[model samples]
Every structure is written in C-alpha cells, then in structure tokens.
Target: MNKPKYGPPHHSASPRYTGLRTYMKLPNVNDPHELNDADIAIVGLPFDTAASYRSGARFGPAGIREISMLLRPANAFHKINPFDYCSVIDFGDLPLIPGHIHDSYDVMKEAYRQFAKHNVVPIGLGGDHSVTLGELRGLAEVYGPLSLVHFDAHGDTWDNYWGKKYTHGTPFRRAAEEQIIDPNSSIQIGLRGTVYSPDDMDAAKEMGFQILTAEEARELAPKQLSEAIRSRVGNKPVFLTFDIDFFDPAYAPGTGTPEPGGFTSVEGLSFVRHLPLVNYVGFDLVEVLPALDQSEITAQLGAAIVYEFITIMALKNRDGKT
Candidate 1:
C-alpha cells in the first residue's frame, strides 16, 4: 500500500514523550498547503467563559492532547490501523478571546469554515459546549443545516442564562434558533440532572429533539441505543458532540457539571462502537476540566472517546463509504 501523506511517527522513530505534544503526535501544521493534505484534522477550541457552574474547561483541549500521546494507531475492536487509510494532522487551536463568547464565536466560525472549504473533517477538543454553536455556524455555511447527535448529562437548551442568550448550557437552543442544526433530525442522549423547571426538559422536545434521559439510555442495550440514533439521524450530515460529564462522576469527575446517575466509560464506548453507518461530518468532545481532575482519568476517557471517532472515520474510508 502507498504511504499515508500524514500520520503520527512510528514509536520506533521517537519516544511519545519527546514530541511537541500535538494530538497523537501528528504533525502540527497551520499552512494552507499542509492543511490541504489532511482528511481528518484535530483542532482545539479553547474558550470556556460561557460556562455556568465551573470554569477551567478552557484548558480542556490541552489536557486531552497531553494524554493523547498514549494512544496507538491500531484499534483492537475495528481490527485496523486508522492511519493506514487516512491522512491525519493536528491543526492546532482555533483563535479565541478569553472572556468574549460572541467574538470567539466569530473567529471560530471563520476558522472552521476554512476546514470545511478544504473538505477536512474536524474532530475538535473543546473548551466548553458553547464552542459547538460556533462550529455549527461555520460548517453549516458549507453543508447547510446538519443533523445533531448530542451526548451529555444536560439538554443545554435553556433560552438564557443570567439574561445572556449564549452560554455553555444554552448552545443547542441557540443552534436550533439559528437553523444551523435541524432538531427534527437530532437526538440528545444521556440527559440526566436537576433543572430549573420541567419547562427545561420540554423546551428541547418542543424544538423536535428526541430526548433520552440517562435512565432511559440505561434501559436499552448498546446496540439498541446506537440503532435508535441511526434511525433518527438517517442519512443526514450528522455532527456529533459528546460532553465528558455524560459519564458518571465516578468515571469522569473533571467536568464543569457533575451528575450522579450516568453511564460508565465502558458503556459509553460500546455506544460509540455500535453506531451504525451515517454521513458523519464532524465531532467534538467537551467539558474536561483538568484542574478538577487529580488523576487525569477524565482526560483519559476524553482521549479514548476521540480515538473511537478516529476509528470510525478510518473504517468508513476502508469500506469505501466515505
């Protein structure tokens, strides 16, 4: 087979700890020419000022990358090495302002728009859930309205927080309003936690999102759960967003919001693994706060989940589905 244009160096060439700490040690590039060669690009979205409960998710991108070096090319379950079929790169982080959500959103939208122009599928390491709203704006410019598959402990559909229309807990509602994501074809899984009112839950459903509370998710087998996602999403261009807090606090404690009744990491992986074929346009994993993570377990789980996404991309290429 011909060599892939871009990939992480083999372990024999250099130690994992010796690199500049780009995700999986892939070449970190910013030039348009270099960016053009990649099929999948790992980019960071490091702005978390919109978070309501806790801060420091701004460091989530760095925290996930710092531990991602431990990831290997081969996925044991997929029985294939992703790098063999796709060119991957670390494109570094999109530009952001520290405390400005709307300004950061503009910059992120333009940056991600460039990725879409180049036909690159961005797997983002996020600063907060609000980052997805910007990403959707950018990608929707290229791909119209997208179907959403959201996994989180919260619905994130609140209309406002503290008189503000945009916050970490309110991106999905904003996205639906902007018509960047079509809620009719969307599904939000693993929503479990206390809310301000019953209207909070009703809001997401009224907007046409198929809601699966954490308890409801636990009732279905992994395959059944995945099938439900596929059935709802169908063949639409789907963008997936995963909040690290979707897992139980015992499994992922370093998050802005912690909920007690959530699934285990193992179960989360099973759901991703069994996800059926669909037109996946992009993915993001958010809300990993390393300052709150004493053991880096949350970061570890975050990296693992992103790796599964990479595997899915590779499997698509291998099967000629891309």
Candidate 2:
C-alpha cells in the first residue's frame, strides 16, 4: 500500500538522545527507491579491512551517527537551516562483506550508485580511507572523471602496501590509475609526517596531484587556504573526501594512523564552509576509530564535519547556487 516516508522526523519535541541513533536523527530509509526525492542521503560504510594499522574504524559510522544526534537543524555560522532547505535521510549502513576488500568495494560501489542515480548527494560515514575508492567508482559512473579535494595527513597515493594494491594506503593511486578522478584538477591538502621515502611526495606529484603539506597549510591564513582549494577544483564535479586524521591527534585521536602535525578543528571547518561554491557530487569523512578515541572527541568532530558538509549543501540549495 503506502510508500514509506523519507528524511528526518521532527525531533524538536523529543530529547536528542531519545531515538534510534541516526545521522542528525534523520529517518532511516532502508529501501533505495524511497530516496528519490531526498536532497542528501547519509550512508554508513562499516568496512575497515584495508587499514594498515588499527582495525576499529569499522565502528566509525556508528560512532559518528551516535554523536550526530546532538546536531541541530540550523547552522549558526552559515545562517541556514539544512532541513528547511532540503530533505536528508539516513540510508543505514551498507552490508559490506568484512575481510574481503574487493568484495567490499563492489558492494560499496553499487550502494553509492543508487544514490547517484537518484541525484542525491551521499555523505558517507567511513570505515577507512580505502572506502573512498569505491565511492569514487560509483560517482564516476554518474559523473565521469570527478575532481578530487582530499583532506588528510597522508597523501594516500602510495602505489601499494606489501604488494597489495587495495590497502587504505593506496586508494587514491588506484583512483588515479583507473581515471576515476582527474588528477590535474585534484589537490591533496594537509599531507605530513614521515613517508617511505622522499619519493613518496614525488610519486604524488608525478600523479599530477598538487600536494600541500600540513606545514604549508599552517603558513597560510584560513581564507587563503580555502581560496587555494576552491581555485584548484574550479567548478568540476568534485568528490570531497576528508580523513579524520586530517585534524591534529589532540582533536581527532581515534584514527587508524595518527599523524602528529595536522589542522585544528576550526581550520578544518573553515575549509568545508568555503566549499559550497564547488559542484560537489559526493562526500565522505573517514578513519574515525572510536576504540582509540578519548571522550569520543574524534566521533564528535566526525559528526561536526558531516554537519558542515550538509550545511554547505543547504546553503547552495537556498541560494540556488548549485
């Protein structure tokens, strides 16, 4: 008989912690066909088999969703209420086959494909950086050769790890090789810490990705850094991928690979706020391993990051900019 409703439930009368843990307390729309009218679909990807270090990021999506219940409808900084402008829903987690990277990727790609087909922007709560490759594949089918705006503490463009090509360490390299992302238009921000060799940076450079080390980002004003990123991607259909480790360990300690030097939470938010001008096709916030986190700060930050992304979408829709 009747079709199921989509988007969030009105929770103003209910306490934030009183409902099922969904992103922004949105309604859980289990069926893909129900997502047709939604402006944004939130999906949890709980696969971390490709992690090189810690394995607990498989809980990242749930962690972020639990924390996201505290998120309000309005964004004070942007002066827009996301729900007032667009419909957003939690699509629940993709049923990933754990311990099998390729199979997981196949599943992720197909899940994202449904969102793309419906013209819904997918904000993925990640399992790890490797999950991004699958997301890129799905979006590429809808919008070919996306421009990439990558925020992370590592380049993630290593050719392989222990001869395995699908590790979290090599997702972007795979994306580049597959031509899923247009490297000339893509840029990597917040790269820092030790690498296998100096050639690590060289490899990313050779791949045509403009690299901005954490040190370099620190040197620029927030506005300047945001401007630099916006100029590079420049109106291309961009897939914005943020690894939680992009923030300093003090702010986001629950990542698989904790890099020492990274951006502050405010700085990270500034970059995301500046991105509403871009034609974003998809977004993901990855690598939040709650088992390693203290006081759930990493999960809190992860939820906030997704909040800003949705705020951007709301602002764009309100202004008729996208």
Candidate 3:
C-alpha cells in the first residue's frame, strides 16, 4: 500500500466529503522534523476532564475538524489566502491522559514545547479552558511571561472550584499565580453572567487582569476594543485564547457554559480581524461541545474562528507585521 499524501486534498481532485479530515484540509505532519519548516501548526487538545458543567468538549477537536472541511484557502474578509502565505499543517492531537488534569496539562505543554522549538505558531483546538494552562506553560517556555488576550463569557480566573485547584474555571488564576502570563499586560473580555460570589470579578481584578464585561464590550466599537487590547499588550509576546462561550448562546450553544449578552458571530469576527497587529505567539479556540450544538452551528462558528486566526497569521505574513 502507498503512503497517504499530507496537506489538504485538492477539491478538484477529491470531493470535500472524501479523504482524511485534517483541519481545513491541511497536510498532516506528525513528525517534529517534518514540521520544522512549517509556519503554522494546527493541533487538537481533546481533554475536558476539568469541565464544571458539560463533559462533551473532549470531542471538540474532531467536531471542529469535521466542519472545517468547508473552509476554502482564501479568506474574503482579510483578502489573503493563509495557505498561500504560510506553510500550515495539521500536527494531529496531543496524547492526553484521561481523567487526570495535571498529567494532561503536562502532555499538552510538552507538545507545545516541541512546536515552539521550531518557531511553529500553534493554533490549538481545545478540550476545555483548563487546557490553556498547559498551553501557557509551553508557550511561556519559548516566549517568557506572555501577554494574554482572553475572550470568554466567564473570567476563568476564580482561585479554585469546589476545593479543586485545577478546574476549567481556575486556569487563568493558576496561570497568573505561576507567572505563566504577565498579569499586568493581560486582558479578559466578554465576562458576564451570574457568579458564585460578587468577589469573583474582584479576584480577577486583584490578579492584575483588565476585565471587560460583556456589556462593556458590546458598548465599545470593535476598533475601540482592538485599541484597548493593543494598548494593554504593548509589544509583548501574546497568547490569544478564545472560548466558544464568548459568543452569545444563540450564536454558539455548544459550549460547556453558556452566557447571555455575549458578542454575535459578526461582532466576534470583527473583533478578531482588528487583532492582526498584536504580537501573537500562539492561539487556541476551546470549549466547543458538539453535543449541544444545534444544526452544527456552534462547530461551524468555531471552525470560522479558527479560520480567522489563520487569516491573522496570513495578514501578518503578508504585511511582515509579526
């Protein structure tokens, strides 16, 4: 038998429904040596053990990949083709330990470390928000103390959840405590909904993260929010994390935690489009629960967001910005 070809299958040669389903039909390169020359690597982190609500996010990576088959090479909004500007490939998924958050985090971090070694910017499809701690640990090893730009309906900055220190709701707090991210330069946008305590926001504020409530974000123009983000990050190596719950439940209902009054899909894309100038080191889109997705809307939106992240990289490459 012949070895399968890597990268996206040609639409003319093969239908979108056929072939191995890599992200956006990109090449699959699992060997670090093969990935050394790649500009962007797409990987799946399919572990959701720490989720406080739904547990189906463990299937998020495959969900996103399945819908991403519809993505074409060109991004009409950005007016650039990501594959044309960068060598993007799928690095497959990391080997995560089931039912063990700490061990899974370690595996995630080690995988990212390998990507960082070759200057490959990783665009991760996440398991849960807790997986971000591992991503930060890995990226920070390459670029010390990264500036974070987090988009989510909740802060995920609570000190702890139910006496456990490593739940999805507590990753950012752990990141802040461990200095995986530069708290002063970090920002969390789209935070809203009821909380366990009024001090929930206070705790995140105390950690030095600039919090922008979903209401405030809705009030600001996309340009204004973009300026706020660029101002806060200020030339630092940045890690951008987007939780699917950042979108209004109407737009993305497949997340573990859904909150009202969040950004619409158009608004979310507009916000992301304005972020090409940020010094992004890595990016991830997490907490996409396919079980709750209505008509695959959430998964499609998640795939579009990942596509936009690639467009950002393409824009940067085109302008020589990053």
Which candidate comes out best when scored by TM-score?
1
Let me know the TM-score candidate 1 reaches against the reference structure: 0.97
Please list the C-alpha lDDT of all candidates, in the order they appear.
0.90, 0.88, 0.88
Give the per-residue lDDT of model 3 (tens digit) for 1-322: 1222334556687777777788977888888888666888898999988999888898999999999988776788777766667778899899897799888888888888888888889999988899999999998898889999999999998878789999999999999889989889999999999999988898888889999999889898888999999999999999999999999999999989999888899999899887748788899999999988998889999999998988888778778885
Q: Please identify which of the two predictions, 1 or 3, would achieve the higher lDDT against the true structure.
A: 1
Q: Which has the greatest lDDT?
A: 1
Clashes of each: 0, 0, 3
Backbone clash pairs for candidate 2 read none
Please provide TM-scores, in order, for all candidate models, with all chains considered together.
Answer: 0.97, 0.96, 0.96
lDDT string, candidate 2, 228-276, tens digits? 8788988899999999999999999999999987888888888777664
Q: TM-score of the candidate numbered 3?
A: 0.96
